[model samples]
Target: MKVRVFVTPKKGVLDPQGVVIETGLRQLGFAGADQVRVGKVIDLVVHTDDRDDASARVHAMCKTFLTNPVIEDYTFTLDEAP
Candidate 1:
C-alpha cells in the first residue's frame, strides 16, 4: 500500500512560513489569496494489503514522529501501490 501524509499547523498557531508565502503572493498581484497555510506532504509505500493495518501503522507513525502534537495536525490516505 501507498500512504500519503499531510502535516499542517493547527488552527490558532502562528505560521511564519505561511505568512511569508501569503505576503509574497499578495505582492505578486494575487490579491485574492488569503489565510494561506503551509504544510508538508510525505509519500511512502507500506507493503500491506489490509487497509486497517496500513491505517493503524500510519497513524502511529504520525503520532510518534510525523507530526508535532502541540502545534501541528496530520491526515493520511492509503491506496494500492502503483
Candidate 2:
C-alpha cells in the first residue's frame, strides 16, 4: 500500500517561515504575493494485504507521532498497490 500525508499549520497558527518568504518576495518586487502558507507532504509505501488497516495505521502515525494537533493538522490518503 501507498500512503500520502499532507501536513500544514492550522488556520490561526502563525507561520514564521511563510512570513519570511512573503516578505522576501515583496522585497524582490513581488508586491502581489501576500499571505503565504507553507506545507509538507510525505509519501510512504508498504506491502499490505489490508488497505483499511494500513490507512488507519498511517492516520494514527500522523496524529500521534508526525504532527502536533494543537498547531498542526494532517490528513492522509491510502492507495492500493499495483
Model 2 root mean square deviation, Cα atoms: 1.7
Clashes of each: 0, 0
Q: Where does candidate 2 stray beyond 4 Å?
A: none
- Per-residue alpha-carbon lDDT of candidate 1 for residues 1-81, written as tens digits (9 for 90 to 100): 989999999999999999999999999998988999999999999998999999999999999998999999999989885
Looking at model 1, report the run of 10 residues with the lowest lDDT sum. 73-82
**Residue 67 alpha-carbon offset, candidate 2, angstroms:** 0.4
The best candidate by TM-score is 1
Q: What is the per-residue lDDT of model 2 for residues 1-82, given as tens digits with 9 covering 90 to 100?
A: 8888999999989999899999999899987878898988988885786988887788788888888899999988888856
lDDT for 11 in candidate 2 is: 96
Candidate 1 Cα misplacement greater than 4 A, ranges = none
User: Pairs clashing in candidate 1?
Assistant: none
